[model samples]
Target: MHQARETDIDGAALLAKLNGWARSLGFSQIGVADVDLASAEPGLMAWLERGFHGQMHYMAAHGLKRARPAELVPGTVRVITARMDYLPHTAPAGWQQIEFDRLARPLDATVSLYARGRDYHKVLRARLQKLADRLAEEIGPFGHRAFTDSAPVLEVELASRSGLGWRGKHTLLLSREAGSSFFLGEIYVDVPLPLTESTPAHCGSCRACIDVCPTQAIVGEYRLDARRCISYLTIEHDGPIPLALRASMGNRIYGCDDCQLTCPWNKYAKRAVLPDFDVRSVFDAPTLLALWGWSEADFLRHTEGSAIRRIGFERWQRNLAVALGNALRATGDADIAQALQGRRDSATALVREHIEWALAQRPQAC
Candidate 1:
């Protein structure tokens, strides 16, 4: 382990100034965390052992090293955890009700609220790097690297340890001030900053998140079966989605926000101050048929610089086809059936199978 060089600097004062820089960069809060995360390793291993990660093999590939920051990034003595609220600035009062209302409409294509914005990975990485540069200017050049939901970092663990917030029962870091509708980013540095005090978990007896999951993904408090999660099925899992969980997916084409939306604490969820998290117009209230109308080229062009692009066109259509199938069963719309037939011949085998399932949702003229 490399030691942080002593520079006769007041760590608390330096952190205060650094917090100012973080605020200017759009971070709502910042906390200093010691790099020792050994205690969290066992739970990480157990979750992997249960295969809760599903097809995300990378979670297991990192093994126990994910809980060890020094192993992941040597010379890291402290991690600066940041929370950036992602609810769009234009999101009105009672936004959760609006989200639930959207889900009730079978024809509406509901992308997760966070993903409707610009790609957060790029936004947070760039801004976190700038925060590191500002720290370098103050303390002279220092060894540091930035991370934002990338690589093998145990982000929620680091955030909770650093007192950004306590981990909610749904397994997301939640703050009484910010709620769960935020993006987390971190800067691993060699600086030995004073650690922030941790907040006590306030979940109490509330099992709102556990009760709200459509797929029953939350097996228990702080335990999740990601394989059964709509968010995981829609965004992370590759190849054919399991048929058992498809009906629970509803019209959520990108990610599911049921747990967070149902959590009473999320009533305190804050809106993003930066325009970078603004909602794209095409996604405002797009119908499943409208998104299905887009050619692969249109998908690429429209989602340019957006996180949804990472899923690529094939998976994009696969998800839409599932939602279209759900819509057919719910709305009994003939236009949706016609749309499914229009694309059946051209779809890839994976998409064709989903298209077949969609077409079957409606019966032929007997």
Candidate 2:
């Protein structure tokens, strides 16, 4: 609850300057939201009650405070929400089809587009602090904190409330100008800036995102069962991945983008303003076998400074094992089977179990 000196501030003028600063800082859009978020609490409670958060206990640990910003960050009276487009600058036209084509090639490994570059957590958080710094310089020092998917904040709720965009059926913030291919970050400030209006949802009758999910993780409109999501299975969930969902994971070794790939709004998706999101050449078109060949050290060295590194080597190997197993099932390639067999003897118990399951997926073995 750091206090700020009492002073008259021009809210609109400050916002205009803020927008300019945000654009220069690589943010696509900026909006301010009031601290009152009581109306969003029920949905938050219901989502947690259904265990939709999967193993993310932190989502529930904060209780209703996530919906109440002031409580989470004492003295916070306004939230400055930001959107930064992450679509790679080099993505070709019809990129969605390119991603869909990658899924068909089980031999090639796939990492989510947003994660193939520098970790957004690092990129956005630093820039957010910079944004806050500029604000302090504009006025006097003020109470402020920056968050970029690093807290219990209801990010999409605040972003939508601040006129950034609406929550599409896939439960992601969507802008008519930027679609859903962007990263969200927030700056919680004590300054009482003018609140922005919420945008109307524009999902219409489209169900492409729901239909395109390989695991049917989206149970219904705007509802996701994290346990069944490939991104969650590969990155968040630890221990054994549910046996039923392994084959559905395909070659996605990190996060999945099927929903965003199929969304019509993504036709308007914008390219990243900063090169921070450009795809690394190593991950540009890597194969499942190539990634599997990496030791823990290799994984660490190659994925340094990237989001994929956060999953740790065990999960990296575990996820690659599943994709290799699926590849074995699809092509029955002796190389794929041999690769799985090579790792079986040396893998950790968790990875060993997955390797055994993969070996069992061979058509003749079946």
Candidate 3:
């Protein structure tokens, strides 16, 4: 537990300096959030009470500590929230429609746009650490820690409070300038910075994201049932996907972007200026059979240093199996059945069951 004495550093002026340093490190915007998040706790408890978080026990494990930043990081006074756009450099205009078309293909392996390039956790963490280093140089080694998408912190709550964005109906932070296609990182510091002005809620009378959800996972505005979300099914949950939600998954193998894609604000989604988010050539035209053919060794080789690697081989196969099941029904390709059969004997029980489900999806011929 390291502590630092605060100097006569003016809060407003320090925030302006931080904004410049953040931009030089590829951050699009920065906002200072006050530490008190007591108001958000009831909604957090209610979401957990409803069993909407699925297998992620971590959300409940942290409890109220998530909202209490000072408790998590002793002496924390203000949280600096940063947003960075993640749309790949090569992504064309009308990219939302492009993603929808990929889902329609059924045989194409549709990874969420964010996961196609360098792991955002690695990219954002390194950049945030650099921003911290720059601050320490000027501010005489101030107490600080950086976090990005780590389970314990309530990142969206902090971002919303700091004027980074208003929380959308899908429960993701949405920026008027950058949309929701960006990554958020935070620096918890002991500086008493002036808090950024909070944005007004802008979701007036719009349920486009709610309607377009294939699994209807957005049960209501700002409420997400993670159990039924394809993104959660593919990445977060470690067991077999629910039989009921398998068909609704379509071709999404890594994460689902349906909610973001349908939101009208996303028409203004900004492209990543940094090359770290450039889409890998492997993901440019990902197909089910090509990805399914990857041996465990191949999977390790290709996804090295990637966010997809974190899911491990077993969950990866489970997600692909579900996608193959959907593909079999859509195209009825015998090759897909052959592919499923090839993996049947050696597949783990979790994956084997998904393979069995995929095999059943092959229509019985008259």
Candidate 4:
């Protein structure tokens, strides 16, 4: 617990100092938001009702508490929303074109670029706490809580209202200058900081993102059916992927970036200012057979600080199997054939089933 000075600090001056601290901490922008997320409640309930959240039962378990920030974090009067650009410094100059080209291959495994390095949850949460600690130094003792995609809260709505960026049609916060390739974090505090005006949506008649989605997960403007979303299928959903959308998933082994790649604003996507987001070697254009060779220990060691670890080794194999199946169908390579054959006896039934599926796609000559 930290305390704030009893002698009230000038709100504007305090905000300026907070921004400076946030920038130093690698946050691209910081905005204060009021807790009145009343408008989002209906959409939240509807999304849950549709079972769009998939196996993430926690989304429904939290109920309306997600809309009530004060309920989740007591004494929270204002929410400090922060954005950190995550496009890796090593990302190619025409990264969007490269990503789209990779997707076109349908056989090349495409892990979302964001997950190819360290887990953003750990990175952003640590920095958000640092920002909170810095605020404590300025204002003395104050009740505050920090969150980075920890759920039980509507982060994007909070961020949009706080002027971080407008919610694009893809339901991701998009900026004319920054695009949608960033991570968001929040600090719920007792202090009532000045709120910033919301940015208006600039996505007029453009529907490139909607048209480009292979799964048709973006049901409409600002609405996503997570059940059909590859990110949810690969990362959030625990069971086997829905049969209907499996082939449509292409070679997205971990997460999907088609929506973000198709967004025109992403042309301006900036490289990460911090080295924390640099792409790791394991994720640097590895072949499906190469990644499928990792043992459980190898998987844990390689992804120790990465978001991919959360999917666990079994799911990791399952996803890789799907991508390998696609690769096998595309290239008819003997290595992919041998790799699928090698994994058929995997201990996990889920992994075995996926391996069997991959083996089924093998050409008759094999």
Candidate 5:
């Protein structure tokens, strides 16, 4: 490990410098967290035991190492957590209502706002590395590693510990200044930086996030059943989506933002300082039929530099098929039926099953 130089370091001054560099790099905020995360282990174990993580085997595979950052990265004494607001600057003041309105449109494909732009993993990871490099240039070399949702790191735990914000009832980091419309990145470093004070949670008596869930994925406050989560069903779970949850998924083809959309704190969500988070044109107002029209090559070409591409074409088609099914059930649109029929024979087995299910959907008599 290339340790930081043995010199008298002013922790406060170093933090100030870090904040400045972070802001200049499109980071909204930066905080330091001590590596002793033993307190969070029991909760981690319980969540895993409940199988709430669904198909994300990696969460269980990492075991308690996720809470023990020092074990994950030897010589790590503090984790520097970063917050980058991801709401596109073009978002209108009543954006929450706008999103809710979008969800009501059964034919429109609704993606999680975060995944609408450039892949956040690529954006945050590169920026975090540059931040680490800047620190190294200032105080000589240091043993450090950067992570942005790419590892088994207890990201929200570390971020909350570092005073980024309190954990919202929906299990996402929420800030008074930025809400939960942001991405978090971390730099595990050997530097003994001053720890930031964790903020008090402000969820109060609100149950908006819990009530608005399409599939009741948030079984309780701060407890998400990933198995039922639209985000997980569409993005993480690589098998057939549960029969019960498909209709509730509505037109969310990529990820669901219903929880975040309903959170009162999100009214304060900040816009991204960098253009990297600007919504891609293809995703801006995509309809289920329009996206269903994309061939595998078109899907690949369009999703280049996108997080959506990581799911591959098969899952993409599968998600769209489910959404089209729900749209057909809701509107009985002939065009949607035609689109599903056109793709049925050519679709992979997984997608074909969903397409078949879609073709079977008919509007119920009221």
Candidate 6:
């Protein structure tokens, strides 16, 4: 563990420097939190016990270490949490309505807005490390590790406790000003920085997010049943999507954003100041037929620096096949039928099965 030199670096001044650096890196806000996450352990364990995490075995693999930041990163005394807004600058004025309308168009694929650009893991992780490096330069060497959503860190809990925002009824950290259209990152460091005051919850009786979930994934207030979440079914789960939830998936080929789109607070969500989150051409309002035409090489090249690449080409085709199936049922398009026919002999059984399902939806005339 690297230790900082014993010097007179004002902790308050260091925090101010951090905020300035974070803002320059396109981060909306930065907050510092202590290592005590004892209160979050019960909720974490309960969610795991309920099998709400679905196929994300890694969530439970870390055990209690996720709640104990100091244990995850030895010598860590405080965590610096940062938020980066991802709504594209080019997004239309009535983006929420536009997104909802896209969902209704069963023939058009609806990839999550945040994933339409460069992968956030790369964008946030690099910027966070730079923030830590700047802090080290000011205070002399320091023990630190940067983490985005890559680890088992209780990021929203830490962010809320660190005064970033209050947890909304959906259990996401929400700010009256920024809403929840953002990504979170953290720097676990061995410094006792001044903690920020937590903001009060303001969800009131609103349940817009809860009512809009396609799979009713939000089983109750603040509790998400990952097994039924479209995002989980399409991206995380490697097996066939449960038969019960397939039709409700609509045209969501990558991830589901209905909950966030329905949240009233999102009306205040700001566009990204950085170009890293701008929507890529391939993902912006693409038709199911257009995406289904992509070869594996095309998929890899197009998703080169994007988060969608993590699922690989097979899963990518499998998901698109499901969306294509739904589109075939909705549009009765000959192109969709031809596309499904083209992939019926896919190399992977998973892709082949989804392709077969898609072909079954073809209009008899096609």
**What global local distance difference test value does model 6 have?**
0.88
Worst 10 residues of 5 by lDDT: 1-10
Candidate 6 stretches greater than 4 Å from native: 2-8, 362-366
| Tens digits of per-residue lDDT for model 3, 81-116 | 999999887888888899899989988999999998
Ranking by lDDT: 5, 2, 1, 3, 6, 4
Candidate 1 residues 69-158, lDDT tens each? 988888888999999999999999999999999999999999999999799999999999999999989988988889998989999999
TM-score of each candidate structure, all chains considered together: 0.98, 0.98, 0.98, 0.96, 0.98, 0.96
Looking at candidate 2, what is the lDDT of residue 157? 92
* Residue lDDT tens for model 6, 1-366: 454224466777877888999999889999999889998899999999999998899999998899999899888888999999999999988899999999999888899999999999999999999998888787767889999999989999999999888887777889888889999999998877778778888899999989988999988998989999988888899998776787788889999988889888999998999999999999987988888888889999999999999998888888888888888888898888887887787548988888888778777765
Give the deviation of candidate 1 from the true structure as CA RMSD.
1.3
lDDT scores in order: 0.91, 0.92, 0.91, 0.87, 0.92, 0.88
Between candidates 1 and 3, which one is better according to lDDT? 1
lDDT: worst 10-residue window of model 6: 1-10
The C-alpha stretches of model 3 lying farther than 4 A from their native spots are 1-5
RMSD of 3: 1.2
Clashing pairs in 6: none
Return the number of clashes found in candidate 6.
0
User: What TM-score does model 2 achieve against the real structure?
Assistant: 0.98
Better of 2 and 4 by TM-score: 2
> With candidate 6 superimposed using the best TM-score fit, by how many Å does residue 359's alpha carbon deviate from the native?
2.6
lDDT of 5 by residue, 1-366 (tens): 455334478889988999999999999999999888999999889999999999899999989999998889888888999999999999999999998899899999999999889999999999999999999999888889999999999999999999999889889999999889999999999888889999999999999999999999999888999999999999999999999999899899999899899898898999999999999999999998889999899999999999999999999999999999999998988898888999988888999999999888966641
